[model samples]
Target: MADPDTLAPPRPRRWKRLRGGLSIQSKLLLMLLSVSLVSAVIVGAIGFTNGRQALQDSALDQLISIRELRAAEITETIDSVIRDASLQSRNLSAQTLSQTMNAAFDELQSDPLSEEQLETLETYYAEVFIPPLEESSETEYSDTAFIPDSNAGQRLQLGYTSRNLDLDEDYQELLAREDLGDGTAYSAAAAQYGDYLTHLVEEAGYEDALLLNLDGDVVYSAYKGPDLGTNVNTGPYRDTLFAQAYRDVTATNSVDAVEITDFEAWIPSLNHPTMWVVSPVGDDDGITGVMAFQLSLHRINNVMTGGEQWAEQGLGETGEVYLVGRDDLMRSNSRLLIEHPDTYAERAADGGTSPSIASRIAEIGGAVLLQPVTTRAISEAQAGRAGTMTGLDYLGGDSVIAYAPLHIEGLDWVINARIDTAEAFAPVVEFTRNVLLSLLGILLGVSLLSLVLAQAFTRPIHRLVGAVRQVAAGDLNVQVPGGARDEFGDLGNAFNDMASSLRVKQELIEEQQKENEKLLHTLMPESVANRYKKGDETISEAHENVSVVFAELLGFDDYARGLTAEQETSQLNTLMRGIDEAAAKAGVEKVRTLHGGYLASSGLVIPRVDNVRRSVEFARQAVEVLDRFNAQNGTSITLRAGIDTGTVTSGLVARTSLAYDLWGDAVNLAYRVRSVSGQPGIYVSQTVRDRTQEMVDYVEAGTVETQGQTETVWKVV
Candidate 1:
């Protein structure tokens, strides 16, 4: 480090300048990009919902169809069971059959069929079941694995755990009816019905159906014993039965009218709850009682779940669909709805108040208050009366609802099927999100690239500004080139040319102003025209004993200002050149142009025209030439010229690029002659006026005294 005494002052700190970067356009682009992304997110949600609804509706419609078909099959099987049992009864008395069944039932209670039942029954077969005889490992014919003639013969005297249900109160309610009889008749009739039901249940696929008497007692069940109750206790079935309660469920008295209802129960079908459909038994007399059959409801749902599958196929995350009930309670059968890994009965109970679905559900109760349930089939059944109903799972979030009431069997139930709406629309929603993200990424990347483009676009502008600043600072040599070949480039080229011209003009003006300064210092300024001739700077006065004349042109003002600088100078030069040539012709020294007048003499200076006449002639010729030049060039030029013979000092006024030749009393008098001149004529003082009059006519405008005057002067021409 240098010592304080040796160190110079620290260099001045320089200010940093603004430079190239993102501009207003870039900010606007980012704003528009953000807005578009937000809009896309919202639009994606709506589009996905629409697609999901379409798919779910399709699936639910098919689900309703399958439910109807399964219901029909059950009806046919129940009809078969009824027909066969009725025939068997007619062949062997119902009472006798009951005795035999009671005896077999006692043996069953004592020791139910062992696991070896298949072996025992196996021996009874004539190898008719041979192909299906092997264990499940024998899958070669698994697709054709169903047993013919219903040989899976395990049987029980009762069905589901109906005793464990709230059947006792239900039974009492049914027994309270006035149309039914006291214990004896009721029991006797019930015994016949039980025998009929027991034989039918055993003869067909054993233990697959449930029987409820006209009295509502679950007289026989597969899980609980004889005297059990109906398994109609869950919310949906309870709702169905509750709505049907306190009403007349009388069997039809006509063969044409059949009433049907289906309720899903907790009995595992393929180890899951399947639908149990009930149709009143219609005899030739009418519908005498109810017949219920079990059917798997899952078979139809697979097809409706397609869109749901598509929406979630590669999502790798669990999703669900909402199938609203006629009650508008949201529910789903998707894996996302599974509460535990193993149990269908256990679902995460997010009840009625979810935000996405709550508002729509609220409309349900509103509809109920306004009328009856309004599903297509319900409305048709009720003849367009709207009422409260339980159909579909209608939770708003990712849900679909499609319902069709089972009408062939003439029941009030609507088949409500539901699946996860997200699952249904998973493919579209994901695709949309991916597309938006891809577009957003592409646009954002392109925006960064556009920054460079913006810089390129603004380059000429930066150069233009730089050129302007340099011009302001008076750098005349600053050269700017054209670029991009647009209007801006043209403007730049024009600017360069303009700067060049201005520089040259500035130098010329400087030289002119400097010479004018020197002349003003050397001679009098009131005679401005004197600065032009070479001799006017020094010669005070000079006289050739010869004569001189003066003249003037009219309307000088309206003319002189119109000429360009170059035209004014050149025309004036031509006029002076003419005068000089005329002087040579006249053999006289023609002087006195320091005042836009002329001087010539005869006698001492030889003269062709009269000496004073030559001066007058030159002055008139100068005026004529100035007029002609103005006319030819579309400019203006005029002059007032005077000529006088007298002693006068005259010499070249030194100038870098101009001339001023003479000055003094004789020159002043010539100017005075001009000053008093009238339009389009010349005048002179008494001297030239007296001498030149012999050669030409002359006129006087006025008398005016001069600077060193001894006598009054007059315009003598």
Candidate 2:
């Protein structure tokens, strides 16, 4: 057999120990909480993932719809521009203006312009035209190349355009001027046809309208711009997109044919992005002259951006639809530039756009041919692919883009509807937040319910534990209810019986404690008695200033000699009670009673400013109390008190039987100033007399020796 001493006792199993430590309520709570938490987490996670994907698909689908709608609208606007030009070219006004302007040009060929007239044309081109063109294009343009070679074109331009150079933006002012008073056939043709063509340019939203003859000379210009009489094929602006459109239209030679040119920085319009739609104007003969309509970016921008009502169009705050040409440059005004120009400039520059380009966009108030948008969406759309994606936008921020190639006839451009991903996925973010909060709420509710059910199952045990704890904490009043017929009920019955017995014993112990406290309080102050009960061996306090009153009842012993011992004791007790009552009213503390003296003090336990006055008034009230006592007892007695003010030390003395006492200069002086065998009256030391002299009348009393000094005393009568 194995040695029993060497064998260890069977160790407790870990699970068994754990089960022993956890109560039934705790086990039930943890199990229920675990199941609830896991379920909430799994359900919330699945819901969040599916909801997020749905929101993403919805946002992308919305963008695609906006992109398709804007692209169609933009295409329609471009097509209308071509159709308008075709209609205008077929108009009789344009055909008659072309023939009449050409005839006038031939007539003015015989009337040569004077040298002064030629000099004025050259000066206008030099000072008013070339300077701004050079500043904007960053290239020099020669005045001689732009000045018309023909006398008719020169005289007409000088009369209608150069004379009204200051009215560039004021189209009404230019239209109001009918004749320049110059006697020429060109002046007559202009005054007759100016208003109709000006109406076409103003009402049709074209920047300008021009009629170019077969010789490539611009014979008529509405709004009287610098291009009024310049030859498109030979002027300084001949290489521009405007001139290309004119040349293309003339080359087509068919009446139904029209040519639309892409945007270019035309020097004639101060280098602003300019495009033109040119069509042939004809009679019975072949194509006569070209009618070119300068297209404005306003119509296209309004279509693309929905007239700046992005929100009403189902596009949120950051959503916008824009166009990009095949060359990767914007073909519409930027919504950001129109609304917040400085922010557009800063964002453009930060996105790798040159400062010069950004500043130009801000200054021109448009980004038709300036702002570049090179992105994956643009590239895919340019390659003829239509799709939705998330990628970096021009401002280097994540954007949800819907891109497609626009199917306009003459332009290779792409339209992109984009919104910041932060704005697009905002719903998904809110859904995620709500899901997490709901998960937490579910867990919180499950936890609370589990706790409540667990507590319900173990409530009897919990009640017993609470009652036992209260009894352990010395509250013997706690009793357990024994209503149920279970083991807990039996335990409750036993516990209530024990609590009843304990409470009875506790009452006896409390009564003994009260008796002890009463005896200690009579020997010392309540504060000192409490400290003694708390096991304090020594209790002492030093008061900085206090008034001590040593009062004695003179002739009390002689009055008591006539009474029996019991009468004397009873009468003395009544007299002491009166003195105690007077002391309480005066706010004075009676320290102890001597054989025939009452020792009291002020500012000992609690300091007071009027302690000297309070002590003196207490002595006077004691005399009155004695007078009442003498009348009741048929005996004569008097009260004499000594009062003084100064520093004093008061504390408990004696270890076996504690006694609170006061002994200091003020105490010694107060004791010595009171006469043991003399007239009965209140006396005070010199310090007390000085402090109370203003409040009380005093007679000079004999001196007393205290602290090795002779202090003068005063008697209060």
Candidate 3:
């Protein structure tokens, strides 16, 4: 007898210590996540600042380098032309031009000396010179018509020289011009000058230049002008080239050569902003005529302007750039300046002043208060220094400024680029911001996940606490639920499996009782039958798995119909019994009586006996039995039987009948023999034929297509 007070259980140790819901692990994970989030933001901000600054510096350097490259290209081209010009001045002579021209004209007129020969003349020659050579010069001077020496046709000639022909085609064509109208002397002098000019740049250090007559006509120059009347003005360059420069050049015998600057360098009167030299052609005492040539500056804007386009592409969306002239005005060709030109114009109008740097900057909605830094590239031209700096105070925002001077052909232009520092390094800043924000989100999410996990762990622990009480109360199947994939899930699954196994164990015991009853039944009739048929130990039932041979008597159907029922039955029974005894003598197992002679082999189905090879022998013995019985009874009979030896399972043909049967190939092949019979005495199947090979003879009927096999039949009589 247990005491009632002992049922009061002792309190558990764990519940007293635990709080509830979230555990300590959750709080720790949340703290780690918060710290990570804060750290990420701070580190990202610092990295963005440093990375952006570095990228901006690299970009500015690249821009400056590219501009420098373009400037170098322009300088080199100018230097080549300059060197060529100097060579012409020192080495070219009039004698060279004369000798070359005479040879060229002579070649043009040499074909059969006909006046019509002039048709093939692509060389430059005056109409007057052509007539003399074509009609008279080859005619010995006195024998020609139109008063030979006094004729106007004798005075002119083609312009050609060894050097002019050897130069680039542009120079050769310029020298080859044919018009000697009015100022023939100037024309002649200019052609001789072109010959020397051709080789000058390659030989000396001077640029290509053209010297014009005070009449704005190209006279004696290193690079000859287009032609005498082919509009010799190079459009906007005409004033700087031909107006006063021509006058000043003509005033002095020769001016030491100087540079030809860009459009901005043209200051009308005193020190003409153009960079060039006027060397006058005259006697040594004083100046009479000027021979002018253009100067090559350290930079050329034509090439530098190309750099602006390149920079715009390189900088992408970072900054705006401008190429300002010496007058502090923006070069009008730039897209930023040209399209929004009114902005600067408006500012100057409001201030009642000429367009200047500060005015233009303000007009364009930019700040004028920003400190402007310049490169000391062209102090002589009064332009400022070049470099990169921040655009301070002006826009009231962070900005970077970079600049370079464009000095070429006496024009000193500055290329200034200003970008918002934030804009210039935007790629790095954006990338950092995104990365930081993503990290912060990941951290916050992790903290939230930690809280969730803490709640989950606590829930399982509480369930475990309740389960412990249940287990103390002797409930062995008590369970706890948690979605954890860790060891907890394994424990839960194992508990479920144990409960399932316990339930199944009781069911197995009950099932064993019914199985014992069924096993008794199975071991009775069925097992006994199998043993008898298989020659096994149990001998309770009769069964035989002999080579069954079923033989049927044919023509009994027609013959029996012509007779009385008694006679018919008597004759058929007599025929079957005779075959039965013969089957018995052959040691065959006869299952029962039938309308036909049915006989099964003896060895496998009944008691074991030797000399029973093929079931065909049983079919053969049945035929002999029927033949002799028919002879004794004075009756005619035809028999067909099939034989095959195989496993046979015996069972009742029906429950309420004495007829029993054997199953499997042994019985099946016997039926086949009955189906395939033709004019049967004793017909046996191919299976019977093969099995009887040792004791009987077989004639292999070639394979015939039937019953899933190419088989043949034989009558073993």
Candidate 4:
């Protein structure tokens, strides 16, 4: 107290010395320049970041829209094809055709083809069918005659040429052939229906149409080639897609059902990729035969590539839509390959694709059917996910992909619309470049002007800088002096408001983080939840000696069908809550609940010494709960549960839906065991029974067929 000046804090002497060396005007000039430079830099950075993100979002939205449109068109096309096939099947289901087809089936089943008939069929194949294909391969058509100059016509011509089987001559020869006739009813019907089928193909835009009997014998073909009278079941085409489709349609015995085969290399079409759509032909009695139509790839290509709507739909130079089968093979030709084969080939080679695949791309002249795709988008879409992603495409370049599953019957296909990322983001990149250049020019001019205005605005700005430094160091309570009523003083007041807002926002952020953690814990195990909270992309672990339980509510489907929507939801919730309580009491984790089924696990999330015993106890308690519910509600609901103990892998699935699930043969066997239990009660696999035999009582449930094997199960008593 005696020396008040010395007692006061040392006064940050170095800062004072530095401040004292500069005039107020010079200090103000530096502060203004620094602020101007930082603002420009920050604004430029924000503009670049926000602009790029907005562009990406817009691009993805457009891609999704295009993908949905293309998917709809494709579905419509498929539905139209199926409808036409159904109509044809109904038309061909006349009593006359049915009786003839049945008679043909009887003749084929009762007796093998005679040597003369077999020899004649072979000669027809060699002379009539094989010559046109060989001739097409050896001889080139006149450019004016077959190669159309128009782009659309050229695409059609390319598809026609790619088929490599000019069957017009074979068709005419077959039509003219009136040689010794086979006395079968099939032959008579074929001769009569041939002209009608030909007209149907011409009118309906079908490449060809065929009528086949139950024995897989082609009774008639519109083109009347080697396939007519050829037995698809035992002939050279026995293993073909058409043969498989025929077998499927015949096996179903559904008159209105149709089977569409996946695109495959059809040897009859000179190894060109081909697709067949087949429908059953029947008249009241049962399915007597099948009607099959060969689809043209050109039409599919046109729809997929946006033949007429490409520009109108805003699909830029690099945008395209295509289809991929479950096998990850292209179902339609690739736009890139069609328009720029050399570039596509070069990119494919540069991406380290197999030489065979690259050579095939070139060989087809950019037609991509049957070409395998290994992109992430196709893989995810095949796995039943619909979304957008940035990844490599079929041509091996970076692309933005939007894909969705195509839910056509008897086919697992995904529709993907994609564009090269560089092209898609070109506007954003150019805008960013231009913005940065303009920002530099503005910053230079502002720096010079800031030096001229420094003297008039130095004191409050210095105070503002000090306050900003304090705030940057995590002290948001600091406030700059604002006695002056000018721009500088207004800035000080604005900074004070921002600091207060930041403090409140920080508090809210911490509270939200705690709430998020709590919510995540309810969704998954605490340890896994914590990892996910810590930003782990994949949270999966393998546990040894774990027990899994699969419980299905028998007759729930029928019971639910009779309940109102509210009643159904309430009843399901009550049942699930009861099951959850039972599992929790037994120290087992309820992993997930599916329709009429619940999956739980023990010793995975929290290891226990008697996991199998716990799982068995959980199942028994669940059955008791259901029994009580049924008694109280006057319902006949019953629980069927299967328990198995083994190693299991568990993890969170899907970023959006976010489900914690378990996967292993043990889990699969548990489900199978439950399904085969037949009568509802607690059913434990042999593994579970063996592990918890001493702790739980069980009676042998006999050997139940499960997953292609016989396994002894036990009912918990």
Candidate 5:
């Protein structure tokens, strides 16, 4: 038996089998399909990259716009508040209140507070102020340290603040309850100018308004808070920025002086953050007490957050603008904390916040001075620069942020607008997904189309390729099928036309070869023309004795101007033909013809013993031809001719467009003799005169200049 492996019909490898199975049509299909899919993928990748960048830029630009707008709004609002506070301090009502309250407080100084009233004032501080203060500030406080000292101050706090702590009435309601029954001049002053100062807090959105005498005593309060009876310059809150602003204005003591204080944690107002604007309350007496207007945090938060209309303000989901102090702590409320506490806590913890702080932020429902916003944007902005960047947000999530420093006086705050990268780049993700899907669909479609097109085009292409090979091998008679009505049919028709044109061009080329040979012989000597045709790039020969004749038709320009261009050309052609026949008959070879001149030679390419005589005879015949034309056309065109016989060099010039020319003493002397002859006749040089005087008739012609030397010339008759 045969070997088992051999009998199994040699198993083909996978690649070999695949290669054998694929025809030209299959290969073409695969190549086109691969190119189409790769191109699509490349295009899709480029588009995705560009689109992602564009979306990122748009997101950052949007953040920057929000940041700038909110910064302007915050600055303007703060400025307006400062102006209003300064103007209100110098108002007539405020000045009168300050003078009246200071007098009333002086009168009530002797009337000391009862022991029960002192106890109530101390109890209010201990229960209402110190506990929350200590909890929020993380510090210990003694209630007695914060309680007011003078009996007059203690009585006022007991009547307005301590008694009204439970009702939770606004400043207007508390101000309306003016009849405190204190039965003292202090009560009368409180009732008299209290409404105007209360209006500052109620209508103007101030947190509180206080009137302080020059001694820094809190003579009156708008909301009657625990700070009502306190001395700002020398009391429990003496170390606060509020007191510092008071001292600053007091030191200036000018009516135009207005001082600002940065936000701080104050024991009053339940230990919440507060800011102040202090200006002098004055009259014609010059300087008096100062009026302090407490700035409301709600107004700032409303401006920064767009009244919680984040979407309407173009801050998409998870976008917010807030303020940060130089301490890297939040100066405004946190959006996430207000909207979702648990979520905020988780994010805050992830952002490296201690668990206790996160819980406390959730407990208090605020972010001011609690949430940390330490980031590159914050650091740069705090350094007095403004810019936009992408970095980790406070929640430790990748975000785009825009930050700028506020221009308000006495405040070191920066504003930031932020959005998560996930939200900002959502469009890019969607576009990427769509592009990938489109690429997949395009690949499938291209595969099917390539297969169909390859099969249809391969048959005709194979035939055309075979025909081209035959034509390339010198078979121009080959034809391809031209029956189908498609591009292949058109290509086949064009091919047949090309082949027919090639056959016609072959016949024309043979005919043109003969004409070119004839024209070349007419231009130069037959021997020189032959050398040039045989690829001789340089063709030059010296003849020891050659006759050169130069002839020009005088008066031709003026004569031809009267004739039309066609008529002029015809007249010249007729004259040239006659001269050519005459030169051939006279044994002279025509070298070249100019606009109205003719150059010819004898014995340059052919040996001739009588070249001088033949050249002079040719010039005589040329004059006769021009005479015939002038007579027939009613013109006075005449021929001037010169001839010489000597050694000459003849060759082709400007090889790209072959121009046969001869030049030597013989040619130059001939040209000079013809040009200076000054009359229409055949002039010959002395060399020709000596050589051809026996055969040709001559006359005495004056000498002509040749190379700055004079030479005798003869006229052939």
Candidate 6:
């Protein structure tokens, strides 16, 4: 160690020393590199986040658009079918068909048919009616004959039984057969009317059409099938959708109102899904019968599948639009399953679908009338919620789905448009990857550029730092080099200009200090002004013994009203100036002046022993000054002065207005005394009279009432 009195300079840490030893160029380069890296990362992250959100929103919009388009198509198709069925139900030809059958049934029920008529009717049923039924039922024929289990199968079985084509002879005999006498005329009318209905069905693209009586008996069929003469209400097919729909339509109060039934499998028509639009038909009576039109599922599928090329309608790959009933079962065929059954099945299996759903997929090979959709989108839509969401699809895959309820009558179904999330967000992923790579490249290039810039700026920056240090040490005369005409040179010029401006401003500031001091003294007492100028917020002092003088011009208001505004202002100013001079001469501080009143105080700012005497003298002088003013201005504006001596507080009232004011009982009493009527001279309070009895002349003025108190006042003359 060296001598005990000598101390060595403390050494910095290794890292601190290293940092201190680094050149300006190295430090600047490091700082720029860090900032650039952080900025690049921040910008890239923000861009990626925004881009992803934008893409997701776009996908949701597209899904909603697709859902709306498909829903409109379905709604239009249903409306068209209903209108056609309604028109046909009310047609004259359909009425004729019903009447012809009704007349033939009435004839057979009222009277027995002759042998010749029975033979003719049998021949007609065999040749004209039985042939078509047999032809339409060709699909039901199989070498291995079997009993049917489905509603469609039961309907076929019931038709065969009613026709006596497949049932036992005893059962056929038990069924009452209608005997139409003189069948030649009835057969011709029936054939012509049946042909007309067949034409209507063919032209309308309907699978079949039937006319039923109020008893739910199919009296006429366009295809002349075995369904004829079968009572739907009590027949073997009573539980079918058609029978249920007929009962519903006939039960309605309005016969003109059309009713549609939900889609269900119709067995007589090849076990295919079918929907019916039924309208009640009536003559002069009420609803006597109902006409049912079978809507072909093929036509409906064509409308719902977007005319066979749904992909062209904005439903991208792995995207489809389908309908779901309130029961969570699919109402329409799924495009994916219809187009790629094997792949759909495999995906369904891999997705761990329910056993019932998987079995239905395997059996039906598609979603039509089979697949159950229990996804959140369908559930919410059926529950009356209409929006888009990201959730698990029917196949357990992540999907973005948009769903809405279809406003179709007699059908509680929701339409959903969906796509795989992976496909929908593919662009977002690719964009994010590209942005990150670009940011990395940009950061790399920025680091190299920052090094070059740091080196270029170091020389100028070192000169600037040295100049700043000198200026900070009060060496404003130091000049920075500005040889190169770049930003650095401009900065040097600005620094020199600023230094010169500061030196000149310093000189002006000193000169302004004296002027401010003079202005402050005029606004307040000397001590209060000094305290305020020294940055004291409140400049208030209490004086134990002080005198307050309040002087008001009597008859000033009446005199001001008679004079012009400018003349009145001039006269008031003259009177105030006189009062101010009088107060100054009497060694009292002029506290404040109002429109017609003036206040002065003594001993508050600078304590004095004869403060009461001084205040009384000031009041007397102010009254004399007003008297002189009245004489010079050719007016009679006398002065009413009040003087009081007591302990009072005085201070600057406000900083902006610079109103110096005196407060306390002495000031209040002085103000009240000055406002006394019938007294023109100076009035002195008891306290003032007591303090200045020897110095001032006072005459007893009878007790005056002021502020609810009676006080004996003395007039100074």
Error of 2 at 526 (Å): 99
TM-score of each: 0.28, 0.58, 0.34, 0.55, 0.59, 0.52
Tens-place lDDT per residue, model 5, 519-539, is 887677778878887899888
What does the lDDT read for residue 67 in candidate 4?
92
Please report, in order, the local distance difference test score of every candidate based on alpha carbons.
0.43, 0.82, 0.48, 0.75, 0.82, 0.72
Best prediction by TM-score: 5
Q: lDDT of model 6 at residue 347?
A: 70
Candidate 2: tens digits of C-alpha lDDT, residues 162-185: 776553556677666656777667
Number of colliding residue pairs in model 5: 0
- Local accuracy of candidate 3 as per-residue lDDT tens digits, 1-717: 888757645323233333254444554444455555677667766776677677767867765665466456555655555454333333325234423433432332322323432221223232322233343212222122221121111222112221233233574354344344535443444454454544443344334444443334333334432222111243223555434555544544443443333432331111212345444433334332234455533223344345445445554543454445565544423323333555544533444434464454543333221113232322322444666665541223455656666655544665555555776666666767777677667667766665555433434445456766775675656665543334444455556566556557766887996786575343334444444445444233333445666667766676677789899898777777767666666666666556654645555444453423535566776667767866786567667665555556655453333245566655676666555635575555676566666667765433334458655766553
For residues 305-404, write the lDDT of model 6, one tens digit per residue: 7776866877767888888887788887777777777677667666666665665576555566667788888988988889999898887899989999
- Model 4 whole-model lDDT (C-alpha atoms): 0.75
lDDT of 4 by residue, 294-408 (tens): 8877778888988845657877888889898877778887776777777776766776667667776776664545467878888889999999999998877899999889988
Candidate 1: regions farther than 4 A off: 1-251, 255-257, 262-717
The RMSD of every model to the true structure, in order and in angstroms, is: 42.6, 31.2, 37.6, 18.2, 32.2, 28.5
Give the higher-TM-score candidate: 1 or 6: 6
Comparison by TM-score, 2 against 6, better one: 2
Q: For residue 618, what is the lDDT in candidate 3?
A: 61
Q: Cα deviation of 389 in candidate 5 (Å)? A: 2.4
